[model samples]
Target: MSAHSQHNLPPSLTGKGATLALDGHDLVRMTEEHGSPLFVFSERRLRGNARALRDAAKGGHARARIFFASKACSNLHVIKALREEGLNIEVNSGGELWKALSAGFAPGEIVFNGVAKSVPEIELALGHGIQSINVDSAFELSRIAQVAAGMGKRARVTLRLVPGIGGGATAGIQTGSEKSKFGMGQAELKEALATAKANAAHLDVAGMHLHIGSQVLDLPDFLESVRFTAEQAKAIGGELGKPLQHLNLGGGYPINYVHHNPGANAGREFDYTPYTATQSAAAMLGEVAGAAAKALGPDAEIFFEPGRAVVADCALLLSRIENVKRRGALQWLFLDAGYNLLIDAAAVRWYYHMVNASRIDAAPDTEFRMVGPLCDSADCYFDVEGEYLWADLQATLTGVAGVTPEILAALKAKVVRLPETRSLPAATGPGDTIALLDTGAYTLEEMFQYCGRQRAKAVMIGTDDRIVTLRDRDRPEDLLDAAERQGIVRTVAAE
Candidate 1:
């Protein structure tokens, strides 16, 4: 069977089919136990994704290691579960490093990567014996060497090279361009390797790393990077007269979201088939390793840092309908969750499938536009005033059935002017339950406490079918306490 068919999610998810089980419990019920606008993760889904990645990396010449890029979603419970599945951890900052440590990952089981590595942070990683540092630039490498020398320790490092290929479901996620402040160029990396060899006492240059981009739907792009990276490794090893121990291929694998949950409207279905093909990831990794083995002498281990692909489908963002507004013939769902929780809206704009968790079997009776409760005009995910891509263009031609042909022509003309604008034309009313499905990755980590609203609670449904709170809902007191601790407020200020 095709990978798409094996993992294709449907238009609606029943309580039994759902890993998190939306139908068995209501958002209101969860809110009572936890709070509103909660994030729910499924242990079953997390494990499944982990295994899928593991399976794809098997049968290759190189030993494939999968690391959960904890920057995507860093809840301690979620991190711990990934650790249990034997996935290594990838951290972008010291706080994330701490979280990975707290989640029971030893320093050697962690790979640290970032642009600005503070002196203390490098010292911390060296102190803890992290697996390797994916160095961003030559300057950072020198800093690591200096820090490691101070402690009389040798730090293992990997150089992250920007492959100049940027791709993702959204434009904002593409980070492989030369303009991006991510990794080092070829010239800089060569110089750094020479330096590492010259001073082998302070630094152990273990491997070459390359992350083309994130959320890449194109498999060939990744394959090309892998081939090129393997070649670079061969060349560097020849020039330095020593083979590197690891080849880190940073992850950009996309997940199958439809299998997780359909949209807020039960009637509308999302196409999830294109992404889940096992052969896609498998074939690409195999080809790359085959070439690398021939060139690099078959001894280096391959590492993959898959963040979004592992966790994106394992969680759902549950929000109650604070109010529903109807404008003309459109139905608008004003959800409690906004750009704060779903921060993807800050850059790439795409509609996450919203589903009526309360009414799973409801017919396709309503056509509507979904909106978030953020006060800013552009704060919501969808721009109602912008251009739209209507699945049924014929239905959009009519608004209340009295609109004339001339008006329809004008609207069509406007839509043509901005071809990429995607808007929802229909309005929805209040008191409905709406959900943003497959929001497990990057959503929670990017959350900001905007509008004085506290962060929402996060719940996880275990393999035992019981619900547990991953994080308690943030309260006003909690925010105030944090402020006081940060010296943003005085004790008398609260009084």
Candidate 2:
């Protein structure tokens, strides 16, 4: 009945009876040395993920290339590690581009992507002569052309098209649909092509780009997106009187968060098994190679800008329980880590599989409502919106004609996101180290200082068994340094 026996753990984690280790490093010991609420990454796992995606790309298309999305985990160490693995970078802003350069990526190995690019951002990209600037709209294309003309340099550009294909587990993550504000529509694409033709003096139309969305679970949608993009590229190339150089299918490859779940209340949406990089590549590139060949030339390259799948499962967050409270029929366990550390949990009802690192081998047969240290009511791990809808539906349907328990149960299944309660070791309580798995991607990038709490530290376990600090924990005095620097407040010496 141990959680390890019931759950599908990531390859980086191994649970023994009283201990949980990440890539052979003890979690409890790590927390004891670095303090609770720490982020740990495995270099071996990271390399494995990068190599797997690279191999999958090569297997699908001989000319395929991967550009690691720096917005996912911009830790310089993480970026440098990926760079060492021969993965290029895709940056969303001027800052990420600078970081990519600092991480040792060549200017030609970087691509810039963003909807609203400021003048300075455009200038910085053109100054460096990066690979391609993904043009989000016709206006952006004009702005880039103007900037390039002023600088007397030709800019490499790609038109981002919205294929109207919606993918991703949540609505917030969908980007390729026509309604999303991410890419150019048919009319805008035409305008962009005309503008590019006119500005041939300052612009070189290198390729076409389309990103379906992040955490995409649908395979057929990818094929449809590729076909649509290929059709657009062919037309655009014909109008430009030359074959396009590449097609960048934005990355939204999904990662499996829930390995095993027995609770009936746990929604099926949370337990989805995602396709591997190998399978996804074959489906997207191999299945649509013929269409790509017919549109672009056989030597044309395929580019991928993956952010989450490459890093999501390479790390875990370790937190310690601070307090335990028992109410009438419910028990609540409070953790030191909260929305400040993992904002997606509260912001989007994101789920990260939790296990008791201090009681790894014990039977996880006890249910408890897990809450964070934040003062906000929505700071808990449960899905707040889903719970509210479920409760409201029950109250509204009561005493209505033809309202049956079976109907209510069926409705409840769709409304609930995460299980109302989490099962952990019966003795799990205060002082126990809890490990949250698959937190490598967006947690650090999205984390912030809330409730006057300092941000957590991050460490990496190298393949050589060396533990290196990626980031230092924020200190108490460090919190006030910002205010003092801005001249808003000053700290006085203690009497």
Candidate 3:
């Protein structure tokens, strides 16, 4: 809301002075009405992203579908909203499978994915007759066969090949590499396919799939992985005497997260545009489709599983400052929420732009340390290395003896070198709200009951321009339900 300059702001945010807005609604008022430490999602943004992906596919292959990655977000309302746009779903586990079903996704529209699938979950997937079970390992392929045999069902599958490609924002999220714990190596995947083909009584190795990790910045690497997957599919189909029916070039589109990095891409600093200006979905589809036609032959149905691109910029976390402290020369700002609300930020050093919601117009002159309410030292906004967790400022409590002002300024300058830094007004204090931008994806799926901090409320600005509660804030009893099950108290747990 700064009148100084409005450049590089996200499309969903607007307003001047102390009143920053989302979908035209004042965030301060929304927080007051819904409660602080909340997640506010823009339905408009969600639909736009979904449509952009679908459009990209249609434009590229003339027949493209997005199996919306359900693990990125599990909210029923959010799921239902995206499903209504004609997008399908991809679930990583039985719990997510249930949520997808509960969200009104048809069996044929749901694709189950995971490294390990328990017997009950496998049975559940078979019972529902989901679209396809993406087999991650040879053992998992055999496990599916056993379960399907017992259930007297024919389970469709796509072998997930590890191309050993790695390019992601963090090592934790890179799934397509052999160094990662997801999917199977190419030789193992080929062997699994042969085994499945041999045991055709219960399993059908009908397709090939490969994901070259997430946060992919280099488009060429991703395309190469796609080509490799198709080539593998052709080789396997010829060896197994079967035609591959589908190919899943899994989703890994990069979103701009760095807000102030010089020479960085434009609109990355709080930019929320869903589709690329030149790199359209049609372009990506055309590239993959052409490759598949050459290697796997024509009629290779295309599929993608987009999680981050569809929802990463659709929501924000609204937190309030509980205290601002200075010890010696260090300045600190403590928020009401912790890593419990957004685990990825703390665990993997994920970057999300922060704003002083209460005073968006004020010059961000303050360089205070940022911390969360969690007693654990790991719950700060800075990286896991704890590089900027504290100021080096040291002065006598008597105020008579203090560090040199010039030295203190130099140290503060060093803190700014880290990936994320917000310049909130110097007056920021208790009750002042902070908005963590670009939090729609990954945050909800990883939220936990750490320190018994209940999950916050999530409100949505609906398509009709009306506000409604998509999910109620987690109550205290929700967290205690698990502990109470151990006979620590009377035991009627959620399960």
| Candidate 2 segments exceeding 4 Å error | 1-3, 261-297, 399-407, 481-495
- What TM-score does each of the candidates earn? 0.82, 0.93, 0.86
Ranking by lDDT: 2, 3, 1
How well is each residue in 228-287 modelled by candidate 1, as lDDT tens digits? Answer: 787788787787778889998888776554333232232233233333334344445555
Model 2 TM-score is 0.93
lDDT of the candidates, in the order given: 0.69, 0.83, 0.76
Q: How far off is model 2, as Cα RMSD?
A: 2.8
- The alpha-carbon deviation from the true structure for residue 307 of candidate 2, after best TM-score superposition, in angstroms, is 1.1
Shift of residue 141 alpha carbon in model 2, Å: 0.6
Per-residue error (Å), model 3, residue 124: 1.1
Clashes of each: 17, 0, 4
Q: Lowest summed-lDDT stretch of 10 residues in model 3? A: 265-274
Candidate 3 lDDT, 1-495, residue by residue in tens: 342253245768876457678888889888899887999999999999888778767656644568998888888989999999989999999999999999899999998988888989999999999889998889888889988888899899988888878766557778877888888886787679677877799988878788876676666776788668767877878877877878888887766664443222222122222222234333554565555445545477788887888888889999999887786665788998888988876777666667777877776655556788997987887644534343323332224355566655455444323333346677888899888888998887678888878888988899899987877888867876665746655444533
Most TM-score-accurate candidate: 2
User: On TM-score, who's better, 1 or 3?
Assistant: 3
Order the candidates by TM-score, highest first — what do you get?
2, 3, 1
Evaluated against the true structure, the overall lDDT of model 2 is 0.83
